[model samples]
Target: MAWVALIIAGLVETVYAAALERSATFTRLWPTLVFLAGVSVSMLGLAIAVRTIPIGTAYAVWVGIGAVGTAIYGIAVLDEPATAARLGCLLLIIAGVAGLKLLH
Candidate 1:
């Protein structure tokens, strides 16, 4: 359940990040509010995950998952950089995440 929550928080963080980018003015109260809320949830989940999971392991996994997920979302939804180099980076992040989980 903690892992599930963490993953969900990561995805929500990705969505909010994308929304924030699209919000041109950066002054839009509603979008900014949502983004803050998402960040809060994500951080809370990270805190929970680190309680049971090792700090280094959980933090690495969290950052890895967040980076890969956000990059994918940026590519698919925002049409931002679909280059091979970026894809390779995403693969590396996933590989690292897998290694952490498997070796931990």
Candidate 2:
């Protein structure tokens, strides 16, 4: 289930990014710990996934998921901009990710 691992990794990457921001430059102890833990798990998942998937495809998918997921998280929870253009861009990324999965 490398694809499952890869997807989990990608989602965890979003958590890592959010936790990093909450860490406040690493000054916040709890968020910093969460960031560190998230990174460990995320990297482990990615490593497991790459053992089977092509590196190029896996990396591209990973990055695409993280980017889109993070943007959505920011918009929904962080009260970031929810403009139509930004949502459209996220849709594009999702389409690309799906395309990669389908092609592979």
Candidate 3:
């Protein structure tokens, strides 16, 4: 359950990051609201998960998932860079996430 919460938090963080990237003007009220809501939820979920998971491991996994997921979403939907080098970095992020999970 903690793992599930942690993963969801990470994914939500990714979504929030993407939303924030397009929210420079602050005129898009809905996306901005969604982003704020997502951030609040993600932090709450991480706080709950931290009760059981090691702080270092949980933080690493959270950041790894957010970075990789946001990058992938950017490339696929926003047509951001999906070059081989970028993909390699994504793979490395996955490896780090997996390493942290294996500690469980």
Candidate 4:
């Protein structure tokens, strides 16, 4: 389904985001390759989903998912700050994404 593809694309966005960080501006060979692969897969999924889903709604959801997931991963695994404000903001993003889905 288009929704499934969109979700997978969003998740891949997170992986690519993390990979981008690890890539060190493409200085590292493996991380750079991973980043490239992630980007390809993520974009392909997004393109597929947009064939069925509205671009505005689909893009917003994809970005929301990626942003939230990447932020959570950064806080939990990358030693980034896990402040109350950050958590609250992340929850707000989640709520927004849910609202978009419900309205759709």
Return the top candidate by lDDT. 4
What tens digits encode model 4's per-residue C-alpha lDDT throughout 1-104? 99999999999999999999999999999999999999999999999999999998899999999999999889988999999999999999999999998998
For 2-100, candidate 1 gives per-residue lDDT tens digits of 677666766777767866776556787888887778788889888887777787887788777777877888888878989999898889888988898
Off by over 4 Å in 4: none
Each candidate structure's TM-score, on Cα atoms with residue i matched to residue i, is: 0.86, 0.96, 0.94, 0.97
Candidate lDDT (C-alpha), each: 0.79, 0.92, 0.90, 0.95
Least accurate stretch of 10 residues (summed lDDT) in model 2?
A: 54-63
> Residue 97 in model 3: shift from native, Å?
0.7
TM-score between model 4 and native: 0.97
lDDT of 3 by residue, 49-93 (tens): 899999899889889889988998999889997899999989998
Q: Which pairs in model 3 have colliding backbones?
A: none
Angstrom error at residue 70, model 3 = 0.4
Candidate numbers, best TM-score first, in rank order: 4, 2, 3, 1
User: What is the TM-score (0 to 1) of candidate 2?
Assistant: 0.96
